[model samples]
Target: MRVYTLFTPSHKGLYEDYFLKTLPDEFELHATELFEQECPTGSFYHEGWDKICYRKVELFVAACEESMGEHFFYCDVDVQFFGNVVDLLVREIGDFDIACQDDVTAYCSGVFVCKASHTTLAMFKAMKRNYNREDQTTLNEHLHMCQHKKLSPAFFTYGRVAARPWSGERFRVPENVLLHHANFVIGVENKKQIMDYTREKNFS
Candidate 1:
């Protein structure tokens, strides 16, 4: 199986330091570094960040389409891993076209596995064709016909606020988490801080 991720110059370190370096040596890794002048660096959401988010979908779609007949895991650079989850996730792909983190309301585009079948390609193409606002919203609308699985238990996805109980937020993490995602936070530095904090708190 192949793993893919897209990042900017600011986030390239996450790919270099945590993603490629810390992860177990069990899979092939691929990354796309966006150099577009229009794309911003930070994780903060804005007009520029919106374009980065949509572009992420475009890059992911291209990677999956080119690798048809195989499975590719699209991961966000802003993450730290504690375990090799490829085998676990692959087993869940039994007959589904995709497997991803589910935050209850919508699919977390931050991390997912693409089976790259014809149906999966069509689904991705549809997202690119009918792109509006961003990727996750359009993905949820088309998922009615998508054969996908929402992953949990073995994976944990949360924001900076919830990771620290002292922040008055409930410390929301599974007892067995393969990795911790630094989503729902602004700034790449802030994300790195959260990823490091969670890894030390749980995986250390």
Candidate 2:
């Protein structure tokens, strides 16, 4: 299997400084640095951000179309690795076409392992067509057709699990966290700050 991830120029620091360094040497990683001259925003849920999401969908579909592997992995640049997640994914994926991180509202498109078959190509292509909504919504719509699995949050975690220890969220900080996706907060600097502490906390 191969790994696929995308980041914009705005997030180049995260890609180079954290993501590239933490990844295990075993997997071949295809990192896409996307640039959109028109929409120069990185904050989520805004028009510029929505445009970026649309472009991200187009690229993901295109990349999956050309990939020759039997299974594919996608991770957002804001993510960090702490353990050998590849082994867990290989075992958990089993015969499923997709294995997703169960974010509170929906399946997180940020981190997932998918089969590189026509079914997945079709699913991602369908995601490309939903221009009005973000890519994750489209993923949830098409997920019903594919055989899938939801990875436990402790293993593949979200930043909220670490960022707000006082909020008393359902998911506590996992002591042996395998991966951490720095989301549920805004801006790159905020992400960097949380990731710095989260990585230090977990790595130690």
The whole-model lDDT of each prediction reads 0.73, 0.73
Candidate 1 stretches greater than 4 Å from native: 159-172
What is the Å distance of residue 84 in model 1 from its true position?
1.1
lDDT of 1: 0.73
lDDT of 1 by residue, 1-204 (tens): 788888878788788888777676777877788877344545555547778778877976788777899988888887778888888888877778888776556677787887888787788878888886777777777776578888765667663234321222335455688876776667767667767767766854
Q: Tens digit of lDDT per residue, candidate 2, span 118-185?
A: 88787777776655567777778878767877877654555334433222233335687778887775
How big is the positional error of residue 93 in model 2, measured in Å on the Cα after superposition? 1.2
lDDT of 1 at 160: 27
Q: Give me the runs in candidate 2 sitting further than 4 Å from their true place.
A: 159-172
- The Cα error of candidate 2 at residue 149, in Å, is 2.1
Indicate the worst ten consecutive residues by lDDT in candidate 2. Answer: 163-172
